[model samples]
Target: MSEKTGTFLVTHADEGSAVFRDVSDGQVHTMASNPDVAEQDVLEATIRPQPPMEVAWEVVEVAERREIELVDTDLSPTTQAMEIAAEQEVGDVERVERAGEGEVHVLSVPPETTEDAAADVLDDEGTIERAARLGAVRVEVRREEDDGVLNVRYLPD
Candidate 1:
């Protein structure tokens, strides 16, 4: 009987149903019917628990919905990001905010594990969640071939 309104990230979508994770609180809501939203979409909506079990939720109204684009580029990390990576040990991740908006995340990893690390970041739901929280529209992943440093930039456009 209660409704919640906030930004949500679509984590899963199939033929008939979809799963959304609340951007603010990380609560998982399973919708009985797909709301025409796809995975990785950020939605601003009001939702109420379904009848009977109330274990599921339904989207009563959608104020806004957008897909956050992901781009993987061959570009190298920024000079500042490289400097931060140089100062940190392997397996360290540093988050730096942009002057205008969004954030740049610098990750230091072993050269042998660089590819795996980048792949992991690209595949993580947390990445999209962070972008949604920051109101970013796109995520760019940059890394040098065989390098130990990677950069994930959340950008608004």
Candidate 2:
């Protein structure tokens, strides 16, 4: 079946990282915004839409969404890795950090958490695949065959 797909405008502001507002809901949140924006959801559900001249409302494509925060979402792969590595002495760690002011999750964490000496463990499962598992956080999947280019942005909380 074809994946449900729609377009989203990457919003950027000096106040914080970019945010992906629902093209239909007029919902706005930080790039690190959670799927459940208690505050914004309330507004979108209760408050009516108004004319903004340039735009009227926004909504995100539900099917294509793989949970990726852009700009500066909080991400913590390192801290998690530290925790996991503590259990295993040998493992590879690549990316870990806060995903802005949103929730916490272990993105691209190595099999080992704390005491790993390698970075490749970050993608034992691969780049985008690992990122896809992270749902709702921004991840750049690059050619796994080469080293460099892959990136994950999690805003600091």
Best by TM-score: 1
Highest-lDDT candidate: 1
Name the TM-score of candidate 1: 0.91
lDDT tens digits by residue: candidate 1, 10-111? 999998999999999999999988989898889999999999989888999999888888888888888988888889998888999998999999998889
The candidate 2 region of ten consecutive residues with least summed lDDT is 39-48
How many pairs of residues collide in each model?
Answer: 0, 43
lDDT (0-100) at residue 104 of candidate 2?
A: 32
**Model 1 scores what on Cα lDDT?**
0.89
Worst 10 residues of 1 by lDDT: 141-150
Q: Estimate each model's TM-score.
A: 0.91, 0.23
Question: Which ranges in model 2 have alpha carbons more than 4 Å from their true place?
Answer: 1-62, 65-80, 92-125, 140-157
Q: Which stretches of candidate 1 lie over 4 Å from their true place?
A: 145-147
Q: Local error of candidate 1 at 79, Å?
A: 1.0
